[model samples]
Target: MSELKTIDARNTFCPGPLMELITYMKQASVGDTLELLSTDEGSAGDVPEWINKVGHDLISNEKIDGVWHVKVRKAK
Candidate 1:
C-alpha cells in the first residue's frame, strides 16, 4: 500500500490549509497520498481546485465531525 500523510489544518482559515497542502506536496513523492483536515468551509472546494490546477489528483472529500477531510494524490 502507498504511504498516506495526514496534514491537520483543523481550526485554520482559508489559504492556510491550502498552503499547507502545497508545502506537503513539495515534500511528498509522486503517487503519495495526502490527507488534509480542515475546519474551514472553503477548503472543501478550494482544495480540489488547487489540486487540479497543480496537476494533482483529488481522491475524496468528505466532512466528519465538522471537519473537512480532503484526500489528494501527488500526480507530478
Candidate 2:
C-alpha cells in the first residue's frame, strides 16, 4: 500500500518549497503520494510543472486559506 506524506514548506519562498518536495520525493517509494504545503503563491504553478516534466502524477493542486496544497504521486 502506498503512503501519503505531507511536506510543510509554508513561509518559504519560491524554489524553497519545490526543493523540499524534490528532496522528499527522492526518498519516497514509487506510488507514494506527497502533499506539499506552501505559502508561496508561485509553488502552485512551479510544482505542477515540475511534476509533469519529471513524469509524476499530479493528484491535485489547490489553495486553501492562502496556502497552496500540491499533491503528487511518484510514478517512477
Please report the candidate that would top TM-score against the real structure.
2
Q: What lDDT is reached at residue 57 by model 2?
A: 97
Error of 2 at 28 (Å): 0.1
RMSD of each: 1.6, 1.3
Model 1 weakest 10-residue run by lDDT: 9-18
Error of 1 at 8 (Å): 0.5
Q: State each candidate's clash count.
A: 0, 0
Flag regions of model 1 displaced more than 4 Å: none
Give, for candidate 2, the lowest lDDT window spanning 10 residues: 7-16
lDDT of 1 by residue, 1-76 (tens): 4689999998876559999999999999999999999998888887899998888999999999899999999988
Taking all chains together, the TM-score of candidate 1 against the true structure is 0.92
| Model 1 deviation from native, Cα RMSD in Å | 1.6
lDDT of each: 0.91, 0.93
TM-score of each model, paired residue for residue? 0.92, 0.94
